[model samples]
Target: MAALTLALDAMGGDNGPSIVIEALARALEQFPQHHFIVVGDDAELAELLAAKKLSNHPRVTVKHASQTVEMTDKPGYSLRAKPDSSMRVALDLVANDEAAACVSAGNTGALMTKAYFALKTLPGVLRPALMSAIPQASGKSAFVLDLGANPVCDSDTLFQFGVMGAVAAREVLGIERPRIALLNMGEEDIKGNDVVKSTAQLFQQSQLLNYIGFIEGDDLFADKADVIVCDGFVGNIALKSCEGLADLLLSNIRSNINAHWLTRWFVKLFYHRLQRSWDWLKPDHYNGASLIGLRGVVIKSHGDANTDAFFSAIQQAVEETQQDLPARIRDRVESVLLEQD
Candidate 1:
């Protein structure tokens, strides 16, 4: 297999180029079959690379970008104003076929705007979706989509998301005939609004999907369904809620364990075991979210991700590119359309 090259928006994330550089160093060691192109201010990125001893590394390359889109910059402004922005340049790398994929922790809207314009959507795809995996009890990840991409989606859009999610689950997660469900207020048929109800009808009617009816908020990680589909507004809130709950639980556990000397000693005795159990729940372990239904692979890393978390995003890019995710999606979508015809 040929070595995959990923373009990184080195100046996009909260910590700027330093964190991206750190991730690059770790990625180079972990994934020997991959190379990277870092885009940012030449002098700053060079200094960070030198400090980390990655400046002379063979697998790393740098592309000088003069401007940067700030975290607060609007998507439209960034698109029109900053032509030389690192995020735009990185996406350009994928568009030009110079890199297999691209990764960024920049403003979500800005990244999406630049990416959609640069790569376009896959054929038969109405729009692109933001899909991420949430760890389930069965040791498999349940795929969810439209996470903040299209806040107000109609029935057709939701159905399209289901198709894309199913293909991704099969190709990337290796699930055979993945069970799909619509996220609703209740498990009953008469639970959600007209949009969800109509989408459910479409899923049930389509032979391409394994439609399993409605799933509630609690079933998200229950492993009851392999894929969950919903509008972006609901999906984004659910994602953020899970992240908040995980943080709260970790903080509460730490505070309780050290509240008393007796409990503190007990916790220390089983610290390793507890830590191993909690590792699965950490957000960093599932840091990458793929913008599916695109012409090329684009991974969105959490803005505040650390070195390890960002590397996980890069791993996602490598795997999806190797799997040729977009081609699989296009094929599945065309099959569905032909079935309808």
Candidate 2:
């Protein structure tokens, strides 16, 4: 792939610019074809980059922002008061077409607010929903969207999410005719409240999407649906629950592996294979969530992400940018809107 430009919110995460700088260094090595712009307090970012021997790297640029977005800041406050924040500056690079995408491990609400403001929603999109891929049982990936981006979505918005999710799966994950399902209490068409039932009706009416009715929480990773759509309220909880379950499984597996000498010896013998399994289950492996339905690509990383997790976020930005995700979404949304009209 050709070299793509990305902006990094150096001062956004809890661990400071140190982790972001370190991740950039790692990403530079792994993706030698990419260019990166690091946005933050110029002095501090320069110092950190120098420490990592990336101060004068050919593909790296440092941009100065006067402020940082605190984790506790409200979305409205951060959007209104901190225009020069690292988060906002990084987002500006994307808006100005200086960067293909921006990755920020900042406050989710603030990031969403600023990103939606800076990038604007794609035509016909009611809101820019956040989406992240989840590993599936068939070793494929399923996408879940509205991940805390829009807490209260109406039927129209939910229907739009399903369309966007399908387009995302088809473009980004190479899933043709991606099966779309609404996340609900039960799998039956009659299981949900009015909002969900109404959303399902819209999906069923659409010929552009592969509407597969509803799926319960248990089917999240069952590969039953290629695209899972829900409001931010339910989607965020589902995402967190998956992460928590992964942690729990890892913890229990480790505990059992060391509980007996035979088990320990067996693990040691198959350590490499077991390590692959562990790596697959690590939540850090999938740390970036895309703010979809926008005119530009924006990736929201976990606020407390470490170097590896942050690097994964950068990787996601690159992947989405390379796939031209926003354009695909824009085109699909236009198509869906025309279908509705």
Instruction: Say which candidate scores most in TM-score.
Output: 1
Per-residue CA lDDT of candidate 1, range 1-341, in tens? 67999999998988778888988888898889888999999999889999998886898889999999999999999999998999999999999999989999888899999999999998889889999888898888988998988899999889989999998899889999999999999999888899999998888889878999999999998999988999989999988888788778777888888898887989867666777666566543456889999999999998887787788898889889988999999999898888767
- lDDT (C-alpha, whole model) for all candidates: 0.89, 0.89
Model 2 per-residue lDDT tens digits across residues 246-335: 778777888888898998889866766766776665443446888998878898888888898899999889988988988888888888
RMSD per prediction, one decimal?
1.8, 2.1
lDDT of 1 at 224: 92
C-alpha lDDT (0 to 100) for residue 158 of candidate 2: 93
Off by over 4 Å in 2: 254-279, 282-285
TM-score of each: 0.95, 0.93
| Candidate 2: residue pairs that collide | none
